[model samples]
Target: MSNKIKEREIQIERLQNNLSPIRKIAGWTAEVLGDKIGVTKQTISNLENKKTPMNFTQYIAIRSVLDYEISNNKENEVLPKVVALLLDCDDELDEADYSKVQDVVGTVAATAAGGTSTDKLDTVFDVLIKTLPFVVPIIGTIIGTSANWSKKLFK
Candidate 1:
């Protein structure tokens, strides 16, 4: 083969490697991704496995789909869970709830960074217990238990 052909093949392999993580993180099976990109399941698998080189149009289509899905998944899955955990919310969170959680987390992070005292940490823990009493027992159990004991319980 020509040098140009070998270089093109290398580029295709790199693209496949770079895009494979997005495909896995977005929870798309090869068949599903192929459907979105207007290709066969075997085509996606071949590209992902580096068994074949993708054409320019195929590369464009796959890139577009992966980009869209990556952004959407970050917003829809990761951000909401992080906000909900920080806020200790048992209910479904909306945009407003997310904003409130973000503000509170920012404030707490800033306070912690500013050499906040152990007393202040205690106060925050008190407030957390008051705000979500149901979490107190869970927290107590975690704090009181040994790692080996917990592992043995599960086993």
Candidate 2:
């Protein structure tokens, strides 16, 4: 590829990388975001994972849809806020807890989508319960919150 073409590809890859965490934090799946952006899930996946070339128009559309979703549903920002507070806590967290955070997100989402795995649900709650000392205070610090937020959510 020419130098200019290579530079453009780099820019596209950078844009896709930046958008991914925002999409996850906003609770959007590829299919859902693709639908909102007038593209297919494969297209979004290609852009995010395979460094597929995207033009300016596609970039704008993807960004606009994500921006709209985040602006309209500020509640979706809770996970990141809680995570930031967890990282700030004086107590040390087990290295395993970091990996379990991903599991908790996936398992909880699956449960919400009617997944029938009771065992997985139990595991998710177990991770949450383990993290309660770090999470509960941050949640309580947030207004309109209560300690009951952590109690047996899966039960």
Give stretches of model 1 more than 4 Å off: 1-11, 76-155
Report backbone clashes per prediction.
0, 0
Model 2 lDDT, residue 46, Cα? 82
Best by TM-score: 2
- Over the stretch 2-121, how does candidate 1's per-residue lDDT look in tens digits? 765565454444356534433543445678989998888999888867788777677557656654663465433322222223322323345565344444444444444455553563
TM-score of predicted structure 2 = 0.43
Number of the top candidate by lDDT?
A: 2
TM-score for each predicted model, relative to the true structure: 0.40, 0.43
TM-score of structure candidate 1: 0.40
Global lDDT of each candidate:
0.49, 0.50
Q: List all candidate RMSDs to the true structure.
A: 19.5, 11.7
What lDDT is obtained when candidate 2 is compared to the true structure? 0.50
